[model samples]
Structures are given as structure tokens and as C-alpha cells.
Target: MQKRAVSGVGLGLRSVHYDHVLSRRPAVPWFEVISENFMGPRGGSGGRPLEVLAKVRREYPVALHGVSLSIGSTDPLDFDYLKKLESLASVIEPWIVTDHLCWTGAHGKNLHDLLPLPYTEEAARHVAGRIEKVQDAIGRSIAIENVSSYLSYKHDEMAEWEFIARIVKTTGCGVLLDVNNIHVSAINHGFDGEEYLAGIPVAAVRQMHLAGYSEENGFLIDTHDHPVSDPVWKLYAAAVRRFGAVPTLIEWDEHIPSFARLQKEAAKAKEVQDGVCAAAV
Candidate 1:
């Protein structure tokens, strides 16, 4: 049997320079689209993004990266939100669909952020149950990502990696291992990044996210608003060494750079991945 194609370094699909992407059509292995942006028919500004996405989907394989799954919330699973996701998946036919493991909001209020979940058995069970229901509803497996957190929950009973491993075991879901986020959390919480990477089940990882961050008051934030930092690059190098070049992405949500600049970042990831592949030989 032939080996399955995995995702390599790619960019987050943005509305800016949509034509440039289609025209130049750079050597992107796979593209990741924000799930909510393309979920439905557009009326005003919203529709154009989906139109471009449809064209891009025809050109390259796309993955779904969601911001608002709210997997950790105690509230009932939002079937309406998930049905929309299912509908969009049918249209775009993504390579993978994933969301953060943390909750976004509760009681119908949009917090507009990825809030960390308490690392306890209770939180694990709650998130795992939700992930199962979501996979069942979408008729596809989903990957969960570890978000960069500032503060740790005092009430939590376990480490982040332990919680993540348990969630994967219970739900049988894959992981979108963000190397940058792990580094950020490790630096903020004072843990070994290598240990965090080693604790994860390598076979469970389907994709990886590498992005830049900002520091404030001796804490690292997953800003995704700047270029890839040297520390993150070091971590990325380590990740490919450990995980064998899992599909990686360069995410820049703010201070958006030109497509050429983003592709440069992709090349960096490719360089590291190639170095790893070479070392194994």
C-alpha cells in the first residue's frame, strides 16, 4: 500500500492577496481554512472569502481550523454550531478538521478567546465527552490543539500533557500539536519542552502549528502576530526531530505579512523538516 500524504508547512488562508495565491499558486502542500468563515452562504463581505476559499480548495487540499468549538465548556454541546461545521466540511472537503481543547464561552456569550480548561479529571471527562459527540455529528475524526495559557488553574490535578493524553485516549481524536504553543506554555510555566513533546503520542498527531509570539512581564503569549521567533524555530526543529515532519503550518493572524514573507517562513519549516529526514537516513 502507498503511504498516505500528510500535511506539511502551509499558511493560514486569509482574504488578502487571494488572487496572488491562485495566480502564482505556490508549492503549498495543503492549506488550512478557518472553519467559521466558510460555513455558510455569504451576503456582504462574508461571501467573498468563501468564494476565494472554494477556488483555493479546487487548487489545493484545505484543512479546517476552528476557533470556537468550546470543547471544555460544561454547557450542552452546540449542535447548531456543529451542523454548520458539517455543512462547510461537505463543501470544502478538508484534509483535517480541528479546534482548541479549551472552551470559548458559555450561556450564549461569545468570549472571543480560547479560555484554558482546568487540568483535572472532571475537565477531561467533560471535554472528552464533547469531542466524541462532535466527531459523531460530523462523521469524521477531529484533532484538538493545546492553547497557550497564561495562568494555571490552582484547582487542577494533573499536568497539561497528561490531560491531553487522556482526552485523546478517551475520544480517539488526533492532535494538532502546536510547537510554538508548547514552548510558550513551557516557558511561562517553567517546564521542559522536550518532556512535553515526549509525553504526547506521536502517532496521534495529524498536524502542527508554528507561529510567533510576544512576551509580557516574563510570560510568553501565543500572539501569532509576528514573525516566527528563534525559540519557536528551535522548538520546531526539535518537533520535526521527534515527530518526523508532521504537517506543519505557519500561522500569522496579526501584523499580516505579504505572501512572499509567509512562504519564506514555510521554507524555514521545510528546511528543518528536511534536515530531520536527512538525519534519519
Candidate 2:
């Protein structure tokens, strides 16, 4: 599959904005849709969602962001889900296909959450092999995202960032660096967000995510409902300084906002990207 360049700030394509996007053709550089939303018993074919998606595709580049790859799971690879994913990718011709680095299920049962993995050499080797196979199954290299964690394993041999860097290094896959997740995990786990960013290989960073987080009893949660927080914007600046102007997305999932509101958030990101790129020059 040929690579489609997806740069600039974008928004998570939600159903509420379908009319606005199709009618107004809002000036979004690209939009990413949850791969599962468009997949079903039909195997990535049919449905009004697709008709709308196809229409949107004619205007802007699209990316398939998945939540259930479970790349780190001990269960055997889910070829069925992968086939559906491949089918969806073929239909959408997305610029990028990405899922989280954390495992979503184990023992053939999905917990429906981004579960943390042990940061061990053995685990890193385990995930790298799965990523290589996934690339083969989909016939296109995909990026793995860093998910926020509320807990850590006592047996972890290295930091979360180190584990991620090793997987990309071994599989030659790209990284979808989520700036909000880093800050949330940092505050929740007591790690330095900057150090995490520094550990990731710069050139492998294919995309970036900015989102709002919530707090519950002193623990930070990776909820995408609110506006992007102050610290996340600061972390994003640091990311742009290191990774250059990589493609970015503002994710507002729970509390759906107006299309114009999403545009403003994306505009802020563009503004930040511009500032960082100019200062680096």
C-alpha cells in the first residue's frame, strides 16, 4: 500500500459532525475514525455510516484508528478482527492505521480497557513479533499508540517509554505519540513526561494526539471529554520541538462539541505547531 501523507491538525471524526462536514466541508486537514465503528458482520461493507464516510473521503484524507488490536495479549492473534480491519482499510484507503500498544484482552475475553503490560525484555520481544505479524496480515505497516495507565507491575524491568522504543525498533513500525496519555500516566505513575518523550525515537513518530483528562481522587484519567488541558499543550510544544511538524489530532470523545469548537481546538494545535517550528528555525 502506498503511503498517504497526513499532516497538520485534525479532528476525530464523530457522527454528530457528519452533516456539518458533508455540508460545509469544514477545513480540516484530515479526520480519523474508530475502525470498529465502521466494521461489523458485513465485513467493512455497506451501511449509511460508510456512505457518509465515502463522501467525506472524497474531500479529506482519512485514518483508521483502532482500539481492540490487543497486540500485547497472550491469546493467539485474532485473524478475524484483523481481516475485518484489512477490509476496512482497503475500503477507506486510510493514510494511517493505528491501535494502542497496551493489550485490551486476555484469555479470549476482552476487558474493554487499555491494560498495561509488564515493561520487561521478554514482553517487548513478545509484542514486536505480534506487530510484525499484524503488518503482514494487514499488508501495511501500522503505528502503535502509547496508552495511559493507572497502575504498574512490580516486575517491570524498564520504563514504559523504553519498552515502546524497543518494540518499534524491533518491528520497524511507527509510533502514535499521545501527548495527553503521557501527562496522565506521568502524573498517575510519578514519571517524568519529558523523559518519556526523549526515550521515543523521533523519526518513528508518525502522528500525535492531544486530548483532555479527568481526575478522580488524585488519579488522572485519560477521558477524552473535556478540552485539552494546559500541561498537555506544554507537552505538545515539547513534542513538536523534537519531532517537528508531525500530523496531530484533537480527540473529544464523550462530550461531543460543535464542529466549530473542534476546529478551534485544531487551530490552537496548528498555532502551537507553527510557533514551535518557527522557533526551531
Candidate 3:
């Protein structure tokens, strides 16, 4: 099998290492930014962080990953939020814009958490419609990522894979295919990981996410605070085999290590992806 070309690995862009990244312009292929971070200039742009992002964006490919958006929410779409997103997108010229498939809140309240939506036809229509609106506002296609959850709904009308498949199919949105999330949700919901991999339409997956998690009280929390665990690595290997070498990223939000350490994690993901392509070939 021909080895797939492994797209380079990157870290989530955080404020802590802005100076280091801008100064060094490290060897990572790209950086994934949280959309809300650079949306507005609360303290004005003369400061260091904005300057650093601007410099880094010029030097490296940047992708915007949002936690908010609440795509699956029952509330009305926030046009103002979409405006902010569009402004940021214009500034960074990100390679892609993406967020969780789950809703953060309903009504006006910001729950500040990625809460799962029931796997139902209603949710499929609701979320997909919002995604379509977002894409329209932003004038481009965006990716939706699978989120880890500790619970499932009793009123679910379909399997998680089926729900996601339909959403992407209907909205023409890309899939992020977070491997660690697949492993986490599979463990929580007692589903087969391989089946989940096989279920997703491979062509719709434009990118991938690999991160660390912790088991607490019989549940997996996406801490992203440590190294990628062995099981998650195996799962990621399976994903690379299925999806070929897509843009993969290593996320470490809390207790982030030094820039060199994060680069090591990205290197590991690249190595595994290369191995999969080699084996498949």
C-alpha cells in the first residue's frame, strides 16, 4: 500500500506560550486556536498576545476550534456571535473552523460545557440547520467534532454514529474525527470503537484530534492535561488506518508542558500516522 502523506502535527494555541511560539516559530506544521480567544480586543491590540498570534498566523497555518456555538441548542442562533467568528476568521485566515457536535446551553445562559445532544432526527435537523447558518455567515464549510460524554439519553432516536453521519451528509460539513473522543464515548456508551470508525464517511473527515484523558469514578474526562494514553494511541492508530493521513493535532490545555514537550507529542502522532500508512501500503 502506498503510504499516505502524513500532514504535520500541531498544538492548541494558548496564551501561555504565545511569546515562545512567536519568537521561535517552532517546527510544528500548524496551531489550533480557540475561536473566542482572539475575537475581540478587550485590552487593545498593542499588547503582546495579539501581536504574537498575528505573527504566528503569518508564519504557520492556523485552525480555529470553538467550544461555544451551541450548535445543538434549542435557542435561536446568535448572529452577533457569528459576526465575531467571521471577523476572527478573516483575521487569522484559518485552514478550517470547527467545534463540538454537542450543545453548550439552551436559552441565553452559557453553560460553558460541551453537553451531549440526544441522538435523534430532531437534533440532526436542529444542529445541521445551525451549522448551515454558520457556514453561510462565515462563507465557508466548517468541521464538526465528536465530543466525549459520560451519559446517554433515554430518548435517543438513533445511534451516535448515525446521527453524526446524517448531520455531515445534510449540512455538507466536514468531520474532525477526534480519536480520543471516540475511544472515550465508546467506553462510556459500550459501543464498538472499530464500528464507529467504519461508520464515519472517511471522505468527510478533513482533520483529526488526539488528546489525553483521565478515568474518574468510572468515567473518562478529556483533561488533555497529560500525555496521550496507550489505549488512545492504539485507537488513533486505528483511525489513521481508516482515514489515511489527515491533519492531526495534539491538544494539551491544562497544565501544558513546555513547547518542546508538546512538540514531542505532535511528533508521536506523526510517527503513528506514518506507521499506519506504511502498514496499509
The TM-score leader among the candidates is 2
- For candidate 3, give the lDDT of residue 157: 93
Put down candidate 3 lDDT per residue, 1-281, tens digits, no spaces.
11223367878888888888878777878889888766654433324555667788877888889988899999898887888888777777788899999989877787989999999888899898899999999898999999988899999998888998999889999999998888889888899988999889989998999889899887888888889999889988888888888999999988999998999999899999889898898
lDDT of each: 0.87, 0.92, 0.86
Error of 3 at 88 (Å): 0.9
Could you tell me how far off, in angstroms, the CA of residue 243 lies in candidate 3 after the best superposition? 0.5
Provide TM-scores for the models: 0.94, 0.97, 0.94
Which one is best on lDDT? 2
What order do you get sorting by lDDT, best first?
2, 1, 3
> For model 1, where is the 10-residue window of minimal lDDT?
39-48
Q: Model 2, range 1-281, lDDT digits (tens) per residue?
A: 33457789999999999989999998899999998888765444547888888898888899899999999999999998999899888888999999999898898799989999999999999999999999999999999999999999999999998998889889999999999999999999999999999999998999999999999998999989999999999999999999999999999999888989999999999999999999888
Q: What's the true lDDT of residue 212 in model 3?
A: 90
